[model samples]
Target chain A: MRRPQFSALRERLLRAGVAPRAVRRTIAELEDHFDDVRRELEAGGLDPKDARSQAYARMGSEEAIVASTLARPELMSWARRWPAVAFALLPAPAFAASFVGSIAVIACLGHLAHSWLGVGLGRSPGLQLFSRCFALWILWALPTAAAAVCTYAAWRRRISLLWPAVGIVLVGVLGSLTNFGVQWGTATSRTAISAGIGISTGHLLPPLVRAASTVGLALLIYAGCWLASRRAEEAGSEG
Target chain B: MGDAKALLMSGVPELLILRLLAEREMYGYELARAVRAVTREAISLGEGVLYPALHSLELSGLLRARRRQVGGRTRVYYNVTAKGRRRLEYLTSHWRRIATAVEAALAGPQHA
Candidate 1:
């Protein structure tokens, strides 16, 4: 009977993962449509089996039906919500911390460089400019580069071990550079003042403090981003 | 005859099922045929719609299900609980109010 054909179609749709409620609703609508088509075929003197087959052909292919059902807005909306949330919250904090910390470490290094090199290079404009530029690149620019790389790696979920390792390396290198720059700048300026030459310790302190604060902030941001990335991975796995 | 019967049958089977179980219990195919006979073939419900609604109503705690062997086929019977009766009363009263308002509105405009 056509009943078995209808039942088998419904079971196939269900096994393909159509929601039960939607399956039932679609089947009912299809049955109603089939009934009208079947009656017309009967009036034309076609056998019941031929009428059923003709009706099935008119309704279109199984792939088309399944695709149309999945394309429904409500089903798509339900499927996309979790993945979108996981992506947004995952990498934000670590990126912030690394960026802030890199800036702070750079400032601290500038301060130390000014203190240490201020005297030896003061008489030579060419030497002083080169030393200042070199200090800034080593202390500030390098850490910024490292922090950026770490953040990108974490976000992409590639090489899980590399992200934390690179982050640790950046903090250590930048932190030392900052300390060295501050102490150097301070010692150089003190030597200049003691030699009866004018020098600015006031300027150096602010940059040093800023550098230290940046390091702290970057660490906070990095830890936060790392935690968030871990949580997103866990959520993705569970879902 | 067909149009009148169709209008009456559209939602009446659901209401009747609720009303019938307002007293006692019944199984799947039995309920289908009983509903058909009660409406004198005005409404013919398939097993498709009936079973799903029964399951949903059971899930919502308005009804409970039990299985029994009948005519060599396993049949699931449903009985209305206290919650079911309460929901039925709420639905019936609200429906009556809506129906009365609609009827009055349609009749008044036509008569005028």
Candidate 2:
């Protein structure tokens, strides 16, 4: 008896916006039920091959199961069911979370290094590099990554592109607010890190440029992913 | 006749599921067997098709599912939630009303 391959069905369910857990459980339950039917038929004097065939009949076609599952709109993933809330309305709070989360992650890593390796907390070249990279991550890479994820998810699920674009722009603006600077301390003072969010009217141009660049980067990533997927599909058809 | 029976079987899986689960918790295979037993093999739905019903019911919060390991095998048990009981009540009443109306219509034509 050949094991049932449900990879195609898994992809279909995912693209249809069924929750990941629901899709997995459905596939698992189907496979398990098939096995039980096969066992039962085998116990009733059928050969293994015949049992397998009977089990397939008894279990019904995957197409039937897929159709039934997809028919229930309530089974769809929450994010897919409400694209605006998941992709647009939530990005603001998510941006704040990412900002604070980034800081927390950096602080945790620094603390680990300090405790584990006896490294001093501040005034080292390592600290400077860490702070700079973290600032860049929060201000640019994080937002780009977030937007790129939303774009990819939407593209994968064949969702409308509007929410993802809005998410990109909103996340980009938030990223621009990740203001950071090196606070130079005098002879009796220590080197300090100054990080604040927001830009004054006098210095708005840089933040605006930062936000625009973040959006550009996210768009570039989306285009690259889209092109790659298209090429793969074309190659598959050709082959 | 077979095609008519098939057509009428729409949503029957859900009804049977909720009705049976309202009595006791059962896994998919157990529920499938119980369905056959209760219907005396009259409603022979492909056993595998029950899962979509079960899953959707659970997803919609009409049923609660929990996984248990028995003899090195995992089985998911499902029970009707309070909401499920209420839904079952509504469905049962609705189904009875439809059945009664159809029965009367079929019988009235014969009497005429």
Candidate 3:
């Protein structure tokens, strides 16, 4: 029995996504098989080429064989984890945390608005608190949505600036509507409006502050995630 | 000829390579040529597919490789080993049983 050649096989295994260590182990096993075939061929008075072909015929389809070898749970797990862990450790976790935190902040702002408007935080008239709360929630959603879309696009190696631009535009429109709504409410109400609270200047300032801060933070997180994604991509390529 | 060659080559390509090396050690390109020649050129194995299969078999402990200088080019020659022979025996025996079963089934009378 003659031994089968393996150097070329190792290269193939690498391209097939087999771990390097596994490739080495598989090579060792194959070497043993080759030795057995060599002995058999020699005993039968067959030339090396004839025996080698006979042995190879028994080994089965290369595609099926490689597929089975790579299908082992541990190897499959390793392959799956490579991309997932690489992406997770990048800006993904940080972005997720920031998004959740922004939602929490928006909830708190809703509470503050309820308290200040003397709407009793929950007993405000005609969906007033609800509308404002919903608006605040949307405000929070704008940047978070942008961040998500951008991060996903970046992960997939696509252009992602659309998210941030759309987010900025949404915020601008929502902010103006909020301001107008507040002004209309104050003007039509009998309640004594706080001079500096919902007045035109005050109304303008709050949304500006919220928009500026949210946009700034969103951009910062986005930039970080983008850089991280790029680094991971480079690392994957190098590997 | 194409169907016959395809059928012969379909399931046990590694065995074919091992059998080739069992006759004589050969490099990757030579092995591919041998397969083509034996099958009367009905089945052409691409390097992309052949190399990967070779690498896999090597990993499976069915083959061994050595570097040799051949006509001024460095060629990696492949050969089979002891364990590979045992596996080949097992696979061949298993295939024989499968072939018998398939033949019986095919030759059996069919109900309308």
For DockQ, the strongest prediction is 2
Comparison by lDDT, 1 against 2, better one: 2
Question: What DockQ does each prediction reach against the true complex?
Answer: 0.02, 0.61, 0.04
TM-score of chain A of each: 0.29, 0.65, 0.32
- For residues A1-239, what per-residue lDDT tens digits would candidate 2 score against the true structure? 22335555656787788876677788788777777878888999999999988888887776777777788877678888888988887776777787777766665665555556553445567667867777777777777777777777666655666887898888888888777555333334444546667778898988898889878877787787778756655554453
Better of 1 and 3 by DockQ: 3
lDDT, model 2, position A22? 79
How is the predicted docking of candidate 1 categorized under the CAPRI scheme?
Answer: incorrect
TM-score for chain A, prediction 1:
0.29
Q: After superposition, how far is residue A150 of candidate 2 from its true place, in Å?
A: 2.5
Write out the backbone clash pairs for model 2: none
Q: Pairing residues by index, what is the TM-score of model 3?
A: 0.35
TM-score of each: 0.35, 0.69, 0.35
True contacts kept of 3: 0.00
Q: Report the Cα lDDT for residue A16, model 1.
A: 52
State the lDDT at A172 in candidate 2: 84
